[model samples]
Target: MVAPPDNDVLRASALHFQHHDGSPALQGVSLGVREGEVLAVTGPRGSGKTSLLRCLAGLDRPQRGEVWFDGVAVHTLGALARARLRRHRFGWIDPVPVLVPELTVWENAALPLMLRGTGRRRARRAALEWLERLDVDGRARSRPHELRHSERQRVCIARALTVVPSVLFADEPTAPLHRAESAQVLRTLTAAARSHGVTVVLACAGPRRAGLADRTVTLLDGRRVRTLHLPPVAGPAGPAEGAEPAGSAGTEGRPACSLSA
Candidate 1:
């Protein structure tokens, strides 16, 4: 077996995955994330960004290839083991917010830490801190149903950061927010991760929202690429005279892709 690098917090090699109906999601993709680094995986829809995040986060195992985390072989771990690892060491934020209806916002944010045996009071304290950071602390006592969709997403982002997990997998985390709110929230998330020494693997539909990452890796049809030229946005009258035009271009993956400072 090929060993992971000593400095890499997460690494994947020759990853291959397919859906139940034989649709491909990842194809021989490989990459590495250094400790405390924020890496953005950018691509258009159906480019395997989310699939790669799932495999690296242990939410799904690749049919072929290896995943290593801090020198441990994550791909070889059983489902139960993976669950435990995720609960204690990893955080995740989805595009949508999901919270327990019966629980208050703070309770939902604190759920993971509480599940890990943290004292209720301590967990609440931690949860409240993150909520405030995400600008959702005022709704701490409100149940999930009481909050707006954007508010709920903020709470979810707070929840994911409360534990300060070693690695956080965020898939389109700001999809529900407006552009202004998205920018503010992303700044908070990335700033917090850097301060806490947390590694982040952020998946996005395009590069527009990936500027906060230390480095970015683009994916195309489940494969890594050197560049992904997105088509210009179409205005009401159609493409502007000097618009770059609608299309994309990319190259196959390169070697030793690193997150440079």
Candidate 2:
């Protein structure tokens, strides 16, 4: 297989996937994410946004197509190798925050670092730093069950950021949040990513959410229909004309984020 360019952090070519019941999800989809760029995948429900994100992140393999990451063919990696890649090179945030019930919020956030063999004291310090960045530091000692949905999501973001993964895959990360909370979380996410030069592939169900991305790829009926490149400076004019509204972007009802890592 031909390799992607050196500047491309992740590349997907002619991807196709089907559901367990034999329903089509992604059909001949292809895209590339540049280093440190935030690319948003948007489409109406069942438009294959989640499936596409999964394939790119190596959480799910497509029946046809190739996924290249950092010069490696991700689709060809064994399960264990893929898992290691995810743990070491990628960060992920889901629509719903899934934390370890027994662990405190900080502990949950530190889990990734701990798994990587970082010392508990150092991991806790790093996790707290991220929690503060996400504005969830006050809840550090609290358990996931004790926090609100938004707070839980913030902690999840903190967890993902603690490792400072090279690429972050966020799927409907703000679905459970209010408009203001969503904006705040997105701001934190994007800001941290920019500062760290983390490439982000965010699957957003709403146009408002996609507004935060540098560019958006729209899918229809499991196929990529169009790609919209947003201006570097967003003005008051609001979503460029012809941009697809969130309503038109199909939601596949799949789990918001990848749990593989």
The prediction achieving the highest lDDT against the true structure is: 1
Model 1: per-residue Cα lDDT at residue 161: 94
Cα lDDT of model 1 by residue, 1-261, tens digit = 557746899999899999889999999998999999999998778989989999999999999999999887999999999999999999999999998999999999999999989999999999999999999999999999999999999999999999999999999999999999999999999999999999999998767789899999888778887665544556798656656534432322232222212
What do the candidate models score in CA lDDT, each in turn? 0.89, 0.85
TM-score of 1: 0.89
Flag clash pairs in model 2: 43-249, 43-250, 44-249, 44-250, 45-249, 45-250, 45-251
C-alpha TM-scores of all predictions: 0.89, 0.86
- What is the total number of backbone clashes in candidate 1? 0
lDDT of 1 at 122: 100
**Highest TM-score, which number?**
1
Give the Å shift of residue 84 in candidate 2.
Answer: 0.7
Clashing pairs in 1: none
What's each prediction's clash count?
A: 0, 7
Model 2 poorest 10 in a row by lDDT: 252-261
